[model samples]
Target chain A: MILPVYAQVDLTNGRWRKCTISAKLFEQYLGGKALGARLLTDLTPAGLDPLSPEAVLIVNTGPMNDTGAPSSSRFNMTFKNVLTGGIASSNCGGPFGMLLKKAGFDGLILCGKAPELSMVVVEDGKIRIEPCPQLQGLDTERIQEELPERYGKLVIGPAGENQVRFACAASGERVAGRCGAGAVMGSKNLKAIIAFGTREVVKANPEGFEAHTRKWVKQLKKHPMTGDSLPRYGSAGLVSKANASGVLPTRNFTRGRYEHYEDVSGETLADTKLLRNSGCVSCPIRCERRVKVKGKDVKGPEYETLGLFGPNLENNNLDLINELNYRCDLLGMDTISLAGTIAFAMELQEKGMGDFGLKPGQPEDLLRVVEDVACRRGPAGELAEGSKILSEKYGGADFAIHSKGLELASYEPRKSVGMGLGYATANRGGCHLNGGYLALLESVGVISMDAQTPKGKPELTVFFQNGMEAASAAGFCLFTMQAMIPGILFKFGPASFVCRAAGKAMLAARPLLSQIWKCMPWIMPINCMLVPHSKSIALATGLPMTIGKFFTVGERSYNVERLYNLREGLTRADDALPERLTKTPQEPDQPDTVVPLDQMLPVYYKVRGWDAHGVPTAKRLRHLGIPLPEEG
Target chain B: MAQVRYHGHLADLTGCRQEALEGTTVAKLLDQIKRQHGAEAYRLAKRSHIIVDRRSAGAEKGFRTPAGLDSLVEFIPVCGGG
Candidate 1:
């Protein structure tokens, strides 16, 4: 049962307010930026400092939570961004988002500063604000360890305590770190959020649950993307795939193809030190690979982690990288942004900028710097505010890959024009969590994209952005979207409201509605008239809702977060890729080729309803229930 | 028409995972193999810097076969492991 009507439960004046949004609004603007846009406009004030306690940090779970949504681990957190001073919202996948729903909490919105260090504990159907001196200033990994095995953790490290501009909220080894959200958490003097609940949020139908899960799990097992390849090789497989496709970013985004990528693929991991396969809770596909060095088991970093720490740094030492990754995780930091910042320092050192006090290919020296980064100590530490800060201090804004202060994820945008647009306009800055277009660019090749040509890329990118937004808002896993489609099966869960959300998502096949209706003719007997229903709340909760109503709520939440960015003073200029993708095609590994991004961006913006400057139009916002408030 | 044998990684690269591919043009063979096996697994054509009878075949370049189209063409994709 929903603790309050609709998925959004607003707490104010010690009473709960239930909001029912329309499905049209939900489909038009789903999750992440769209939800953030609505929420921030409503909640954020003008010229709000992102690091101030006045920053409204909303941990919003997507519509897909509590359903057997495969790879539906996505959830959003919006705040005044410390990086680009724009509207910022970061999405991530882990147990925390799922647990929030299970605990009967849709999302957590905490405003007003705490006088001292405190932790939010949700255990056994109760939420309490408690002080925890011991948890203060602890690194993320240590805090994760302190949590009972049954509970999920969202904690920050010394970077947050130091108010490092790029600090992240780490859960297990995954993170929602960017735009100093962790620093926002720290500014509130909040230490951690430990959540535990006994009630299982599995679907109401046990037999349907078993059959549905088994069928999808079987499909996943058979689909080459997940079964044999990703399960065994993990994301590391992308190293070679992108390299072969001529888009592996190497030597600090100078080239799309890494001549040394052979040294980093999943095949290399399988041949070398890969110790075991790992996975998230309730995940049938084990995509994480556990590696060992000196007999110390370390969480094997993903492709994004490897892209930055390995090839991006010009460091090819595999064994040493294992230890370096271990140090990052133990310190509770996001390796992607960390590597991006370090790469900036390395570029500075190579160009006779006289050592930002760094040794480019030396993993051991880099390991020492990890602690300093997390704590913002010493030379490289000061710029550890993030990659964009390092770029501003140095002279390589050309190479600094960030949007709104958050560094880019591991995908080389030069190879995937669609992905490049996704990175450029992501609400939380350069982030792949918004949408990963590599499946179309290199793996599945479903979108008929001339990846090397940039033809139709902008339109394709816009399509992916919308589809991903809808899927993630429904809270389903994205990896599945890469290979298969998540369809009407979702309506049985919170994600099903998007069944009609297809108009927003550009699909290869027709919409799920047509497909479902067509299948009904085959599955059911003749002369059956099935009527459409509104976005109804769960029967267990007895709350009334219309399909049109829920999406409006979802879109309203998105706008509020966008306003948070506007309050932070972010503008169109803040939403774009570095010169590597825009002004110049990345220098080809072959010595004379270009990624052709110039041929892409204009087309991308047209479909997105954004101006060439990358700002969403007033017409666009009005259609999606996003109110544009007065600006500074 | 010329035939190329699929072996080891190439076998995995081919749709059959064991059988060789037949084609008149080098591009056709590679495209056929990739379509069946999936592009993610067919990167062997680039990785294995190969050699036919005597001369070298460029890693990614497509080429015509020898006069004797029925000759036993060699499968020499570059094979390296760290």
Candidate 2:
């Protein structure tokens, strides 16, 4: 079996299929983010309107999923993003990844639009896709309540039905919420996809799983930031960290730092509003915080959401923040996107851009806009299409905080140069979570190659992107480490362990990363592979190999993704960041503020063997098991 | 001279979180605090925020500023909410 567990759903046929793709030709490259993009290339239409039924959604799960890797629950869902006007890979976590695997599937691919309003229900291996007109007006809260108690449901809201370009799909309170995926579902007339199962995932080698799980879980608990600050405060804690640095997004990305930022920080929220802790299905670290707002507790207001509503618009009332958070979840909108939409409106209104219909610091007016956006009611609704669309209408493009049409999250690039590069070049459009290299750039500071200068940003960001992609492929949460530490970044990931080692060689390495990488370099991605210094896979899985063969698999997969994007036309232009970084040096509220991306991207591409266009060459592709484009 | 201010939960911990100290160097200021508040208090104070004027002033940097009897630095650790 190549891919351990994944599900394929055909909305038209109401069927579910599972397979292991680890042994597929591209299996050597491994379908991590790179392979997932390739798979979409195999299916998704080029230049097609993203919201059409023909557009396919590919959710990629990696081999290490549910194997107890730190933050191992993150899964990537790729689709044409109408909001960004480009491709996007949205990540989310809930029970769906583990359940599908338990039920014997590697990943889920939804194809062929439903004939009418319908919801596909997968229970006990039985698949049923049919029309459900009853779901038309329902929001995520309603859908979450109605879905089977033991199942995970993915559904879109009314904004999607209205074909609002910025609409999203939410699973429970966790949203694959960016890039208008919900809008795509709406276009397909597929209201929801509910998956259920009770079967246990039978491990091929339970001993290996247990050993890997214990080692990682212990390390995660010992991680200073993850163990102490994170679980207690959640990403909400950054509310204070960012604001204190004068790098918080306020007044529609107009400036960094908010006068009232301290009031809405994560610590304040945890002290006042945090009611409970929630998590995805099998995750031991319950990092998802449920906060009480307006008397009703809801999922969360993560860092981006806090930035969007708190500093971006100058709203500091935790009560209002709570209510706003609830509104986004129930309205079936993404908090990050919804917050940006409102912030954009605030900018237009403040600037007298024909009063584009909202005011800064007015929560009630913001709420009205939220309603309008979700239901596509009027001018406000149209303006709410997404931040980029809203910004262009207001006669401002340069000041508009978005990449490729997707609104930028809360990070102020002026505060950190590496993050500036990451935001500019994120595969999913202005998302910090996607690359999240800034976390490393500041504290852990990998690619020590250079941190103060943008000399090697592209390389740094790409390495993180590929490594993170590998982790997420295993369907793990990125929160395993509060910040991405260089040690873990270059160290042993158990999935890399098993993937690298041949039976006998793995036995000798027995938990040592170096041995695994040398023995099975051919099986893992080669660009940057880390293996156990010593460990025997044969003793556990009966498979053994030396380390040299393992590193190639991972490195090969990294290059394949670049080649795939090359096929889809993600060129030099696409590889660039926003105008803000390119022209004006970002100045923070503090002194010595200077954005440094001007020096980073070149060194980055060189390290990956990609030409200036960000395309991996023919030689790189041949090495990774990725087939080059056929000469016509 | 430097002014130190208390902030957030840390402010509540100190009896008077914000204050001004006279010294030519951070080490001198810290030494003065050691003599006045005792080593235990000075040790605890080091763990918190110390603002000079309005910008962040570390213990090392706060004491290094030109020493004088005037309070040109605002040593703050009181409002740190981040």
Candidate 3:
């Protein structure tokens, strides 16, 4: 059978080693987040700072990557978070994953630090660590332009080179934008990594994989959410839904609604600013919006960038949002964190905590602050430290609006309480995708459950989280997974009795679902529904990829990350949202409008089989086939 | 009569953002729209969520609910990206 291979690089000594994963480990963890998490846990030394020379960066692709699977040209980077000091798995959509595998490696692991500014080149199964000081300090776009277009390049810019806590790595306008992975690359004095190869990915069953791919692409194209709405407006389409749902996160999350939200809404973007639509390799949905920034056509802002840079900072200029989005991309900074930090600074100044010279409704200062944060100059240097640290120093912990150091996404959790639970308990901290993205079901998506209610949220949160984790591990775009919700549900409006029953049925299945999880391998295997990634994986890797096994793989991956975080000194205390989310109600007259995290946390812990302290029980770990950490 | 304002492509299909339609429930309003425009208008309506008087109908009031007298309705297309 074709087992996964890891190319291990010792950056300190400039040597590389090839290691094939064992069958036992391969069976338990597929590629991408699953295998990467376990590898990082085993290979990384304890107590190592994320930016230290010794910390490891593991880039992995799923079994179906480059096999013509829909949106399968995705990869994951797993490492210690520079901001949170916890497990961080950031997924990106680009040709890099396909190129990396074509170069004859399923994954690449980098350890130690280079002595000087350097670049790693992989071509035709050969690896070369070359010293390249000329590429240092260049913007992400200029660096990419300087490199040969034939190679898929992953590069960082000033934000990363300066080791900004929220630095992101850019690849063909796609980004691994969370957990400061780019900063870790910067700390190692690594400027960029370019991959080029002509190798073909061999599928175990070529005909079966091809049939599955055709059907999968058809499904994605036909699905209303993926085919029509996304391609038409891109992710910016969600701006209107989020704002209407009272979850747009205005003014550092002080309120959930924005009056001028229409100025930057997706409808406005599509009508006035959108130039064309684009997407990653092998993706049919093509949800990317190509818009003009400073007279040059570039990737438009997604929901996070639109909401955060637009309303969260109280900026009503869509043109400014597009400009900032492009600037952040060039600077290699995560917009969520960078924008959140600036918003936090603005609030701090408003509250008389510190003077960073930022004010509400002032969009002009934002451009200068973006530059300052990327270059680590002036007051933006302190802003580069992220909101969690700034709050600790400046005394605004209650309204800091972050969970576990990383800034919260644009979705205001008080309006969607389950999202609050997700933010508080997410492994990577303050990430919407990591927190299960229940906002889709609760308020934003087709199924409209009560947003402020906490009942049955824990179970739904776990279900979405597990499914998303499995999909990410399989190297599929999360948007493809959105089709898993039956089309009939969209046919029936959210207020219909059918939709409510569906919601109730989902919540009611918690007990049976928990039992099935406990049964593990004994449970009957099925391919499940619209999520065809498992079936494709089974045929491609010759591995048994039944739905049960797929979920188990995801569960194992999540538990392993939890185990790592636990070892790194994370406790239940860290699994929490800010006071503004949990205690303060968005609608003061309505006491129930606040996120009732207290009601959900206990139930969530119980469902996950973790003790009151949120540590996974040894029995739970063993059941998932994960070895307990030494401390355990 | 309920006032309906279309968003995204829904507006393009109807050739107007706001219109007055005679209907109590969203289904009937969609039926009237389909009769006046075409199947595409009905298709767009099906895939879109109605916001009654600026509040999202996804919450307590879905398409099944009545348009309540003089309710200013907004048809926002159902799209997922984030």
Each model's C-alpha lDDT? 0.58, 0.59, 0.86
Q: Candidate 1 at residue A49, lDDT?
A: 77
- lDDT of prediction 1: 0.58
DockQ of 3: 0.60
In candidate 1, stretches whose alpha carbon ends up further than 4 angstroms from where it belongs are A1-37, A200-211, A435-439, A442-448, A485-568, A587-599, A611-613, A628-632, B1-82
Per-residue lDDT for A401 in model 1? Answer: 74
Model 2 segments more than 4 A misplaced: A5-8, A13-22, A25-34, A67-70, A391-394, A443-452, A481-566, A585-596, B1-82
lDDT of 3 at B3: 90
- Per-model TM-score on C-alpha atoms: 0.77, 0.82, 0.97
The TM-scores, chain A only, for the candidates as listed are 0.81, 0.85, 0.98
Q: Return the top candidate by DockQ.
A: 3
The DockQ for candidate 2, computed on C-alphas, is 0.12
Choose 2 or 3, whichever is better by DockQ.
Answer: 3
* Native contacts retained, all candidates in order: 0.00, 0.00, 0.63
For candidate 1, the per-residue lDDT at B45 reads 50
Docking quality level of the chain pair in candidate 3: medium
Point out the higher-scoring one by DockQ: 1 or 3: 3
What DockQ does every candidate get?
Answer: 0.09, 0.12, 0.60
